[model samples]
Target: MSLLDLDHDQRKELAERVRQDYEELKSKDLQLNLTRGKPSSEQLDISQRLLELPGTEDFKDADGTDVRNYGNLKGIRDIREIWSELLGVRYDELIAGDASSLNMMFDLVMYAHTFGTQDSERPWNQEEKVRWICPVPGYDRHFTITEKLGYEMLSVPWLDEGPDMDAVREAVKDPQVKGMWLVPTFANPSGHTVSQDVARQLAEMETAAPDFRIVWDNAYAVHTLTEEFPEVIDIVTLAREAGNPNRFWHMTSTSKITFAGSGVAFLNTSTENIDWYASYAGARGIGPNKINQLAHARFFGDADGVRQVMRKHASLLAPKFNRVLEILEAELGEYDVARWTTPSGGYFISLDVIDGTAARVVELAKGAGIALTEAGSSFPLHKDPNDRNIRLAPTLPPVAELEEAVRGVATCVLLAAVEKLGA
Candidate 1:
């Protein structure tokens, strides 16, 4: 019988069976982790050539500026130029930084609240409270950043096309809504690419807050598993054309493309925003590590080289993704206890279990010696009111381990669903 259709006694029996299986599995000394959205060792190896690019007297920019010494607060010119091509933005509009674009975004919010942006009439701190529109089933780190800053977060349901634009429009009408976080291309966890129509509507929407900006974190811009994926219209261009020139603060990084801990990151926006942010950012530090930028520039050479590198990543990752899908199909297809997203590209497979069962499933998986990202992490404030969403990361583990992990997760889901129904 399906877990949902099981009687109380049957469910109790099923739970006991699952518990016994988990105990046996845990005692097998198997080590498998499928929690974080991290790339595998083989994926990291693809960019190993970057380390050799800046050896034996090659540490200067084209203008004779020493790459090792710090001065350009907005990054070296050539590095910006390279990223501009990758991000589909102009070089002058981009501000390349160190490996942490997320850190930069946090600083942006903090600065806005304390001192405001160039266009603001007053600092956000003087206001009653600042608010942000958080799309549900989004990146946990994105929500955590806003919550930690004490900004009032309003959760908006994310559709396959993107976030519900109607809700977005209504939310932004409130004067306290200062910003919204978005991952437009193959978004984190959900892997839903924002539709072109939705992108345009978001750009053109009227907001009561004059300084409202879209915190567009394109963390997985080029990390695609399939060539048949939808093409993302450059939101910067769309926003500018829609007469909202400063509507977006775009960010990207090579964390997944190169070494996760040491890759370069960048932000792109309108000229006015760039000038203001540069002036503010310069007060703190001299600049990002130019040597790293030079190394990446040499390693990738140009945009085409970067695309070639992504193809290698796709080859390594596609099978792992398919394996998870295969296991899900084999174990849970007929029972219908949950549904999942089959993304064309991106780093995650988002699963939606029965309401109020996700936390139990995660606990059961842990008992079986398999780790997962904490349940409800995909939602704002780590609160999934329905307790339904779970993000499955398949890229980090080997194919065999991923298969085993998927089976374990499937078993957990069945156990949890059955118990919930019985209760």
Candidate 2:
């Protein structure tokens, strides 16, 4: 029965039962974690072949460019082509960089703050206020970048297909709203893929700022749990057709697909934006790790090779995701105290416990030696306005440990909900 439907005495009895369950959970003294969506050791082992790639003596790219040299600011052609096909960008427009896409994202924000975008009248720092549109139940690191820069972040509801279009369209009417953080496909926690209609609206919408931009983070472009991959929108082309040529700064990486510690990052955008980025990026460094780029290129011979790798990833990740769903349903469904996403692809399950009970659930998990991403982490500035959301990562732990941890979390969910009910 729904907890709300239960009588006072029933609630008290149920609370007592859950408290006993909580005590049992703590007594186990388990040290399991579901804090970050890191790939498991088995998942990591799928790409061990990367170690032998572009072997020492065979370090030259297909074009015979020596990868060890400090040149090729645009990165190697072969690597760029593979990602271009996968990311829906032209080969010439893509720039392969070092491991982390987060680094590239940070750099772009700093670059814009100091130098402005290709279309900007002045640097972002010179402006009085720079507001960013952040889709809630989104990526935390994306929010952290703008937060660390002292910029204001506005929250927008992320619907099943994408962010609430009407809200985003209105937000951009203010000149202070400069950029937005978006993960177009299989988004971080919610796994809300942006539909073509939404993508077009974002591209075509009129805005007050000439320099309005979107950080098109395709972090999970090919990271699908299902066999059918999500569609990739031709965003840059759509923007150009809409007369907003420099509207997006695309970023992607193989950190999850291959070796997380050593992976190739990609940046794709308009021709003008590329030129603008190169002028500034060139001043900062000679080039990215071309040797590493060559190694990645050799590992994934083509676009299909990347998809094939993602399938291996799916084989390992799908079960953990399923187990979490099954546990959540079995433990929390009857009480109607929790709801979660059943994602076709993505690393996280966006769990929402009873209203105002997320922090309590997380706290309860912590007391029982289970580590979860902090409550409210999915929002800008680490604040969930309703305090109703939690991001659960199931990819990192073994299925056995994941099941136990999720059961503990479900127990905490019930305990917290009942506590809130009594209050």
- Considering every candidate listed, which one attains the maximal TM-score? 2
lDDT of candidate 2 over 1-423, digit per residue (tens): 899999988898999999999999999999999999899999999989888878979888889878888898888998999989987777777898889998988988899999998789999999999999999989999999999889899999999889999999999999999999999988889888999999999999999999999999999988999898888787888998998889988899999999887998888899899898889989999999988888888888999999999999999999889989999999999999999999999898999888899999999999999999999999998999999999999999899999999999999999999999882
Question: In order, what is each prediction's RMSD in angstroms?
Answer: 1.9, 0.9
For each candidate in turn, the TM-score is 0.95, 0.99
Clashing pairs in 2: none
- Highest lDDT among the candidates is held by which one? 2
lDDT of 2 at 340: 93
Whole-model lDDT, model 1 = 0.86
The residue ranges of model 1 lying beyond 4 angstroms of the native Cα positions read 1-20, 228-230
Q: After superposing candidate 2, which stretches have Cα over 4 Å from the reference?
A: none
Q: Count the backbone clashes (under 3 Å) in each candidate.
A: 0, 0
Q: What is the C-alpha lDDT of each candidate?
A: 0.86, 0.91
